[model samples]
Target: MKKSLLIGATALALTLASPFSQAHRVWIKPSTTSVSGDSEWITFDVAVANGIFHPDHFAYPAERLSVVSPSGNPVDIQNQQKLRYRSVFDVELTESGTYKVFNASQSLVAFWKDEDGERHFWPGRGKTGTVEEFYQAVPQDADDLNVMETANRLETYVTLGAPTADNNKLTGKGLELKALTHPNDAYTGEPIDFQFFMSGDKAQGTKVIVVKDGEKYRDTAGGVEVTADKEGKISLQFDEPGMYWLEAEYEDDKAKAPAKKRRASYVLVFEVLPL
Candidate 1:
């Protein structure tokens, strides 16, 4: 017996669609962006929801979460649980610096038709499969064969005593965010700069979409869009103090064989404080 498939038809449909246009948003919300104490604890909520910060759809898998300490060390999370609509966890910050909480993943998705002319998908319809499994199960001459590689990251920042840049360094493997302005130091009415990277290089002309919390109460979605400059940087300012969601996506033809394209997406939830 094989394991169940990681993706279903609906999930495959969403994967083929525009990455940024998806209605379901995935995020990790921290109790506080800044804190102080010898040992402070921060609670987090992880969810895939239709509304910002609202966990109405499904809980993001808690097992996929991780925390990086200010010194670039792996920190452990406590009290993790998955409920009906959200996953909750707590992190104990013993170091007096910033922490990076995130969920990052990469996978290959494929579509094809078998000899019988029946449509099929790599990883199949009912169970998960690996690259080797995909190669063995999918015929080399399969009709309409299409394959894509995807990398996605969802992240939030929390500072215990002071912010540190050690843990914010980019891995240079996929799409990533480099904080020119410390994420925990964002303030209302003041501009904060951030740089985007794709496979370690500057992601010039990347489009970044931002939406503040409380979209359910507003008449309009009130989302804002900004494009990265030639330096792969964008500056943002908020009028009111609140939590905001920021996302960026990039697609290219850098994928290896069996995969024609690569799609990378990055998401961050940060707070803006009143001056």
Candidate 2:
């Protein structure tokens, strides 16, 4: 009877945890996508949840939020707020070009036991390392072992003046989605193309999730999946004007070995304007 109860509880835990875990994506949303006047202040909110713009989940801490100016420098924000639903921060639009708001967190610890009774520990952060480097850090006596690392990296951009295709400013290490079409200048009914890169190389076989922000406060998207071509490209078309979030995930199956799995996630938030 005790064994049966234990198994039942475990099943219940997995059932409840699956949806929550799958939805825990981090994203940032600015108050406006493009600014033209003398307005120098922009307010934004940041959150970590399945629903990108929805405030149903937890907000990212202030320390995790940051801004990069148009002149290639980090800028400070004010009116900082944090709540269960979402965290809010305000930035002064000092420059006239495109401004970037970003948040990156450290890798946490994740562990699981496989059918073979082997335990695996991986960093809960976003993509961080090569497959060999990942397993090399694991202890050989990893029978009840732990070997892995996962990290979360998120970014969003706002145009201060005329929109430009300045993709080079957003380039960096790890998994990134480069907008082939100028993000802020996109219009409804137009396809927004993005290129995916893992560790600076076109990452093929990556899975992307695209969802339109809804009014009711839910993370339900039925999830749209798209595959990257040989050159690591994927796109989505907006039928109407509204906000949207895109998330890409890639797993190193060949590197998992006898272990469970190693994967990375990247997220982007953009808006579509009406024609």
TM-score of 1: 0.88
Quote the positional error of residue 101 for candidate 1 in Å. 0.5
Candidate models: Cα lDDT each = 0.82, 0.65
- Using all chains and alpha carbons, the TM-scores for the candidates as numbered come to 0.88, 0.76
Candidate 2 per-residue lDDT over residues 1-275, each given as its tens digit: 99666565443332222222464666788888888876578788887664546767656666666787777778887889887778888888867887777754323234556667854445322323445654565445545554333434577788888765553343445567777887787798888888887656787988888777773455455456798887889977877787777778765543234345445577778888999
Off by over 4 Å in 1: 1-21, 113-120, 124-131
Report the C-alpha lDDT of model 1 over 10-48, residue by residue, as the tens digit.
Answer: 463353232454778888998889998798899999887
Best of the candidates, lDDT: 1
Lowest summed lDDT across 10 adjacent residues in model 2 is found at 11-20
